[model samples]
Target: MSLDDIRGIPTIELPYETIPVTEASAGIQRILSLAYMLVWMQSENLITAQLFGRSPARQLIFLMDETEAHLHPRWQRSILPAILTVLKELELIIDIQLFITTHSPLVLASVEPLFDQEKDKLFLFELNDNQVTLNEITWAKQGDVIGWLTSEVFGLKQARSQEAEQAIEAAQAWMRKDDMNQFPENLRTKEKIHQQLLKLLPGHDPFFPRWIVRMEADD
Candidate 1:
């Protein structure tokens, strides 16, 4: 491929189209830049081997931080697999070890089909007793992204706004006749908690039916 300097910005000429790295979307730019770097490394290794009779490297360790950054959910789902596929296709690279960090549940879900229990391990950094501890997490197939959000990895009580989670917690405390020392003073009463729930939660939220039925039963 050819490189052209247009207005001081480098552009790559591909078979189908020419793309200026600066003009492309953030996700596209990141992917293009990574691919270019890998190809350049391979070429450099080949030239070194030919010129100096040096042995080519056999293994590569790739460290990627926030693998899902700036990527759309669809792209996040495919990116990890795509990277592995590209490495396999590279003639010079024989083995690859990838260390990737991501907060997107979609990224985890995407790898479920490819995860090998014997070959791979998942790790979690957890806060315990005010100390940050690292633990090796067992890999399980969460049926979907939502499941991942609520799993031990994410530790979300509900996949929703902060207000909704608090409202639901207050409502539960009221329903169970528990002490309200930790809840907001304004939300301690049943009526006030119910109003807060109505304001924060959607009408179709599953919590509504249980709360409403309990209220009716109390009456």
Candidate 2:
């Protein structure tokens, strides 16, 4: 079935059923996941609208586990925002509660924005072994989610900066060794230096196409 058809389905069972997209089409799968999430949010909105006239005291609790499993980083980034938007939209209509467990950094980054200073409606707990520790994220007082993320509690900025710097250094080294024959004789020594750098590097870029473009440009 097409992605549009999959999005129309109310519920999707995990593990037992195939996600309907292959690893080769990761970008498409990410888009499909987002569409499915939005559709689910709309369904919840409709259900809450109907309950408003009747049993307004009825509580709805949604439990999402490993929400970022099949999603790419780009799509994973959307999960928290979509959830927060749904919660805010349904706040008055229904008493909505959510319990989500995720290992994705993107998911955590998305949720860091929803904390409120006046109300303890949002809580974040980190689990280690059998113990759970709650993190006192002060985003509500910070005014911006990005600001709070860069703060000591989150340290997202430092982590991202380090990762980016390593990536650029690796990319530069890769471009230098991409084609030894294409370069002039005088530049051949640079290729040996690049090979040494590659051995010293800690990580690999499996997405070769993005780096391939830079290799071609160097010629």
Candidate 3:
């Protein structure tokens, strides 16, 4: 009921309750969740054993859903590698498998530097033409988080806000048109399109030439 009662490790006492980790943030709570899950899986009780200090199996598989949940960008980057280290500790005598679903670009960018193609693969689930499809892609190193956001795994055309995304799509649609002067939303003039693109995309964007020049050339 008191910190001294639990070997000075702290505890949550009822009514006049005091949680072990007072004022802890969600990121810390995420770590505790993982630690507790490991403890329960191996010992069924938190007090019986220290969770990750020793190997619990020769071969093990871990499937994590949204491992980046509640973690900051820095933690998101380091989480997968840290989990792998723990799993490797558990799998001292054999190989291990990790399947994790994540939507964080930081998470992908973090793994980009350390992922082994021989031991790892990236599965991308894309919704296209109202149907969902899965593809296995060769692991690629996207050194920048923005690059990871635009990568096929993330399926983003632009690593910008929703308005920017809409402008880029509109520009693309305009470029695909047979007539350069035709603008569906009164973006007919070259100046209008140029200004819109400048607002939506950075100067060095790869699509700049295609949308700006090619569209003008057709006129």
Q: Against the true structure, whose TM-score is highest?
A: 1
Tens-digit lDDT string for candidate 2 (1-219): 576555543333356664535533554566466567756765776777687854334466767777777677777878667767867776766676777766555666665566445654434676779899886554444334445456555556423345343444445545655654444343344345345334543446443455546655766
Best-to-worst ranking by TM-score: 1, 3, 2
Clashes of each: 0, 0, 0
Give a tens-digit lDDT track for model 1, residues 21-83.
Answer: 777788888998899898888888789888998787777788888899899999999999898
| Candidate 2 Cα deviation (angstroms), residue 79 | 1.3
C-alpha lDDT of all candidate models, in order: 0.85, 0.57, 0.72
Candidate 3 TM-score, true structure as reference: 0.66
Query: What is the lDDT, from 0 to 100, of the residue 90 in candidate 2?
Result: 63
Error of 3 at 30 (Å): 1.5
Superior candidate under lDDT, 1 versus 2: 1
Question: After superposition on all CA atoms, what RMSD does each candidate show versus the true structure?
Answer: 3.9, 12.6, 7.1
Q: lDDT for model 1, please.
A: 0.85
lDDT of 3 by residue, 65-103 (tens): 888988988899899888877776656545567888999
